[model samples]
Target: MKKLTNFTILSLFFFSGIMSSCKKDILETIPNDRVSSAIYWRTESDAIYGVNSVYSALDAVNLFVLDGVSDIGHTNTTFTVEFNIENGTYDASHSRIQTEWQNGFRGIFLANDVLANIDKITTTNTALLDRLKAETRVLRAYYYLKLTGLYGDVPLITNPITAAEGLSIARTSQADVYEFISTELAAASSALPASYPTAEKGRITKGAALALKARAHLWSGDFAQAAEAAKAVIDLNVYGLVDEYGKLFTYAMENSKEVVFDKQFLAGTLTHNSFAYMGPYSQRNSSSNFVPTKALADLYTMKNGKEITDPDAGFDPMQPYLNRDPRMRYTMYLDGDPLPSGILFKPVPGQGGADEVGKTQYNTSTGYSLKKYVVAEDLQTPGASGLNFILLRYAEVLLTYAEAKIELNQLDASVYDAINAIRTRPDVGLPELQAGLSQDELRKIVRRERTIELAFEGWRLFDIRRWKIGEQVMRGPVYGITYFENGNPVTIEVPSVTRVFDPAKHYIWPVPQKETALNPALGQNPGW
Candidate 1:
């Protein structure tokens, strides 16, 4: 990723000028102090800053914490909007819901500003100009993807429009919105470079555009397009899975070859507090958040490539954490795991330790802390790590290809090779899938592999939604490891917050009431 410089400073000004908390229709006007199109979009540097400012809208907190809204996890804080969301108490009026709507459009507006004005800049470097334009278009498509994924249909504001004009635009059908995104991404993929130099790293590449196209097609159930798009990314050969899964999340691996697109961060200038959010209670200066439920913990397979419930797997409940997949220890903060403090993470009751889990102040309810993105050395500093939030990576491309093949009922040698590449990764060292499975069998395997591989990286919510299984897994008791009694792990079942996923309404968020009131043309979603 590029270092902090004029881009960071100018992005702050851009955000201050355009960001608003009111309804999307009337509150999206650009402030007078902001860089207006008339005078500001005349130079290459101006064009550069315009696109960089749009990247500021990508927040790690919102993107990464989305998994908690699914079955596998929950936000640590109670009585909050996220908690309400997990428990199915959220409505159109939730502040976070409104923020999602506002932020998604805010990014879109900024990208539109760049696209509308960049063409006016006098640049002899046509290649750079095309790349910049392609990058902006891909970002706009990404924001639209987020919007349509959360809200079934949304207002498709493609150009820079006045706030007054926006008030009269009605919602576009989700099919149309997705079609627009697909078209934009396809154009972007052609113009973008296959990769970028280190100095210009973290910019969108052709592979990222293709990967997103595959994601859109996959979610829309267009298996053929998804498979073809994913294959295009694979053919690029510019990216591959990192040698080790754990290294992919470290500061050393920022902008690594595996990352197609990421939210870049600099230590002193543009750092986020995700480590603090993912840390244990004692490690945190205040409240700890983002604990994993047992549902997630149990998804890891045995080292021998067998599920714990399989009778042939030699499962033992007394020593449940032992002999599990190597990825589990790297991904989760389990009891008896080594800590940076030269002690093990002992979450047993009355352990009098930082890792203790229970009803105490700042304690974890699920008896687990996220270790995937947490830097062990940064535990003392809490919110000081500059780890980048990886939005798209090569691993996802592989999984998308494998799943698309399975869905197409073309399960062949290529499908096995893709899934095995991840499973038998040098760091993982797990056994591969056996040969010659039926389409139905491989479909289950591929989905489970995605669950275990991408556990807390915030892809689970969309996966369940797209799979149409929200009611089955999301609406139930959220279980967690409680305490070890007589050397056996006891699972805690909390009845206070059983989730309820109403298939009728919970599949997509409702348009905020404030927006609907300000613009009567904007209608509410079903069962709001």
Candidate 2:
């Protein structure tokens, strides 16, 4: 909560590699090629610039925060790329994750510098300085959360040190790392304003800080703390699940009550920085690589309010998406629905590009592709959407609270309220919580709702990890239904390892070999 006085955040920005891409209009004429404290953090404008640099770093887009943890990397269940037996030439696994492990650490290191140096600024207004510090802390906490989740344990560096000092530091245990994350967020939550004024409405708020704390604790398996943190956020009552489910994803409906923290994307200034930016709307829509699987799609319970895993799980898998969670409709563009911007999709005759030979490939198998994060109103825009990516939201908090409550085995009145709030959303029409259900049963229900509600907001990666259900869920020959020209479905197969990983090693990714080599001080996780 202390104000950054003599310390200039802009100095830290220059020292750390200048990698900001958030709001383009607010530019300071700081020479990017040079590193000078006198020239950099001298003006109040410089401080704001520094803060945006931090936001840009923390924001999910410009930096790929959870590249390793998400489905695209390892920990995927049911979708794997098979090794080419004939190719003695090339071998690939999730090595990109290990190679790029520094991205998370780089963000953390920059945040640490900003946080440490903010107090040194002498002429800055006390209130403005504190706000910048708090925002940096929240963003730092986010980077740390991603780090801890992926590696389980990582070096916890609060104060910035020289490269030599950093190299000698060993990794901290996950427990300790999360403790620091919680502590930092708690401080940030208290320091940040209850709400930023209209001009800064989108900035991190006390609620956003607390909401993030709640989720951080939830992911670390600290259920009691998670519940308490979640309670603190709910007490704020500033946010709620959007009345309509689809509104959460579209650009027109950004920064709603449901949105707690998100990466803001605009039409012109900033590129559509989410996974959607890569989505190909037409024939060559190959960039929608970030696809949801059948496991995710099937996890959503039928509107009749029955889970797919239920005794009467009588719904058809062939017509797999029918009567499932309404979120499926909002999230992915399936075979029957019209494409975004009013493009009607006809079934491609074959995998070959004969119909539209050179068009883009939005290869949505079984006629499904991602619609989330694509800006709808920007239909006339020159290129893709500018939808801001939300980092934290009340809906995820609600579910986190529900899951924490269930995990603690105290499904009392408070628990029911949180669960029911989401369950009875206009799209998800399920019966109210039943009495006398076991804790595990409630946990199952919580998990089901998470898959349906928070599917592609980058929640599932941590969700699967926290539940420790990777072994059960991520293994075996995963399958997806690819629709043919006649609307008939053909089963396309993915390799076993792609979908599954060895359970023990799967929960934690291999520590970057480069990191371990450089820092003999660090200890590797069990398997890797």
Candidate 3:
């Protein structure tokens, strides 16, 4: 996939004529290195570059570090955005809230800019032009999806707007925003190809549009529409799960067939610090800011697909890591587990272990570090991992289909097949769920499957909110691992931190304070 270079982004910003200056002389001056819209949109290359700039927003850390705010993941640092959100201490003035809002609108503005100017190019290839427009629409819908998902009702801006117009725009209802997203995706799906050439691998596709549509509907509680859209992607027969569950996150599997859509990154150019934030201190010599909580580890069922709380599950507190779901190891590094860098992860306090808690400020606070998406080579240099983050994959689509069916009380064979496909993947191979289960039973099973299958992929926060389980799961003392101390097993609660979630307001984040301040017409969320 071709990413937008820094220079290209600057060029696009200049061509859009969106940058403002306080001084009239500065506003009138043009840099020799920048091109105006009149000359920039005269070629086919310009159209492609303009659309590519929109993909840059997809790489925002706010999108990927979302699990830190949920019960499953914990953010250690007190100053970071995830910390504020996780602790319920964040307000409308939070930097991340503002950055997320601005980034989402920036993506929308870039996509709208391309849509408004792509026709200016003198291209004989009408098919390419249509595909580009479809791609831009998909990206625009994606931004709106993130915005409305986080802020409830956000302004739905589909066209490039002047500063004066942006100042007074009121918030659109979430329902209407989703309706527009669905309409755009439905139209884009038809114009997009099922697959792109290798050189254009990460470009948005028909499956991406349909899969996003399914997610949008699922989030909005439109089970039937969500199921229909997810099934459309499945029926396309263009995607399947990769053989190795763990390898799917590695750089080696960047081109996996399971990926419906992903954000592309180059090692030295556009990259993220995910490895440094999630890897063991011994592996990266950096603080593990985001680590898996004990609650997440306990969510995985035993090898027989029974919850540990079940009497027949044969779970031992002392031997918790043994006889559990294979994904538990694949997703996180437990005590005594060997890391990719060939270091034993022994986070026992006062044991002099490299990852031991309180050994150093850089050690894992949760006594466990994330194993998924941590490339050993990337550990050599923090924030330089080129591994593409899978935004939407086949597993999510399958699980979404199952959950939608379960929600609609349509417990059929296809639901079982969809869930079983992921459970029976060659590397996972957990026991297949039995048929003829009640809708409620299937719902529980599918929810658990989605949680374990997609852990740390930034969906848990939204899942809890949409399922209305925020009050049940979000408040409590967060815990870490169970380790033996002088022959006695002990579970450690993360110290000096309290978790709180008010069902009334925590379900949806507040609109950015700066935004509401600038445009009072954009009212605040109910409890914010």
Candidate 4:
């Protein structure tokens, strides 16, 4: 899909202003200087632009920063708001908490505006109109899915409301919100095409809707429904695992078969600074804002699919990087690993490299740097990274199906097939999971696969929440890589702070204080 250009953004802003304007005298001459709904939303271009505007709210920065709040990743920059979340010190008034709420609603409002005004266009192509409405509904549902995932219960506003009504709106139950999302996605899936042309690659598809529905149901613990939804996506047969796991993230391989849906970007146009935040300090010439934790590294199984802690796994503490999962190298840069710039990544303290821990302000706190999504071009200009951030992928859908089936206790052949497909992907080539395993055993395998397969992709935090394992994983000291020091291996504490994940209050975020303060009807979450 082509990135939204400056012209499209300017046009969207113009239409947004017109949509927000109050009713004017109908008898008076329509002013050319301003556009109103009466004069707008009357063309194909109008509908397309309106829907495209809603896509802008998929903020790359906010989505990518989510990993920092999970066990897999850590935010090293203490000056940033996400660092507070990493340490579990954020509150209702936290800036990131407030923006997540505001941004979600902003997307919902844009979608609602499109849905409310789309009929104004008089087109004989009923198919086109239905597709546009379907797209808008899916987008709106996505925003609600995100909101409810974090906030538990949010005001489910499907229509454009007056300022007075907005101030008085009350929070809706999470169950009802999820039900609405499921219904919308199911209906939208039928109207959307199974695939789009290369020119329209990033547009939402039937698979996207089904994948999201599966995610929502799984998160809600509706295992049977989640499995069914995921199965529907698989049955479509329109997506498959990309041959090269790492290439799936590159600009050259974006919109590949593995990607069900992704946020689009183009260099010098709609871009983000992910490279600057996640890349090695040596390459980006800046401090890495986010770094992987040892907890994440420890999750990667040995090449033979044995746990690294296994006595037979042949893990060498002196050479920790050897004989580990290939994905570990693909996902993160360890000491002595060659970087994209062909320089060895040396994060050991006093190594005199920019990425060396404690070497300078522009150093990694965790002794490791992210390798995923760190394109070579982005390192040259770290602020303008055009790499598309994948929102949904076929691998995730497969894992969701396998997990839901395991939770449902179905234990069918399809479950093994789903997981083995990812395990034995061409580049990964890990040992296939054997069949006839007990449900509890399969459950552990699938969860571990999710952690390693989707690391640094912003799914760990949600997995921690949905699995109710926050207290176990989130409350502890975060550690970095183990390195040999004078013939002894020593694991260093990354941030020198103990994380606190209070199950009583940390499971769900409190309603942002600004929102609750503005609208008293929006009550605080429990134990906030």
Top candidate, metric lDDT: 4
lDDT of 1 by residue, 1-528 (tens): 466333756766754554333344655664477654435667788778888888878757666568878877876767656888888888988887899899999999889877877888898987878988999889899999888989989999988887898889899999999999999999999999897777777778899999999989988888899999999999998888888897778878877778888887777676777777766666644355667888888888889989888998876777778888888888888888876556677766677766676646466777777787677656666676677788988888899999999999998899999999999989899998888899988998899889878888877888998999997898778788756677666777754777889999998998988888888898999999
Model 1 reaches what TM-score against the true structure? 0.94
Please, what are the lDDT tens digits per residue for candidate 2 over residues 311-429? Answer: 79667756766877687777766655665546564433354522221133334432345566654465455244566677788878888898898988888888878988887887666
Full-model lDDT, candidate 2: 0.64
For model 1, where is the 10-residue window of minimal lDDT? 15-24
- Candidate 3 similarity to native, TM-score: 0.95
Residue-level lDDT for 226 in candidate 1: 92
State in Å the error of residue 361, model 2: 7.4
Candidate 3 error regions (>4 Å): 1-30
Ranked by TM-score, the better of candidates 2 and 3 is 3
For each candidate in turn, the TM-score is 0.94, 0.83, 0.95, 0.96
lDDT of each residue in 1-528, candidate 4, tens digit only:
455444346555766557454556778665676567667788887788778877878757666688877888888777788878878889999999999899999999888988988998998988988998998899899999999999999998988999999899999999999999999999999999998877777778999999999999999999999999999999999999998886777888877889998888878877788887778878847557788899999998888999989999998888888877788888988898887678889988766765788777657888988887887767678888888889989999999999999998999999999999998888888899888899999999999999989888877888999999998899788899888778788788965678888899898999999988889999999998
- The Cα local distance difference test for each model comes to 0.81, 0.64, 0.84, 0.85
Candidate 4: where is the Cα deviation over 4 Å? 1-11, 21-35
Worst 10 residues of 3 by lDDT: 15-24
Candidate 3's error at 178, in angstroms? Answer: 0.5
* Ten residues in sequence with the least summed lDDT for candidate 4: 1-10
Worst window of 10 by summed lDDT in candidate 2: 82-91
lDDT of 2 at 509: 68
At residue 335, what lDDT does model 1 achieve? 85
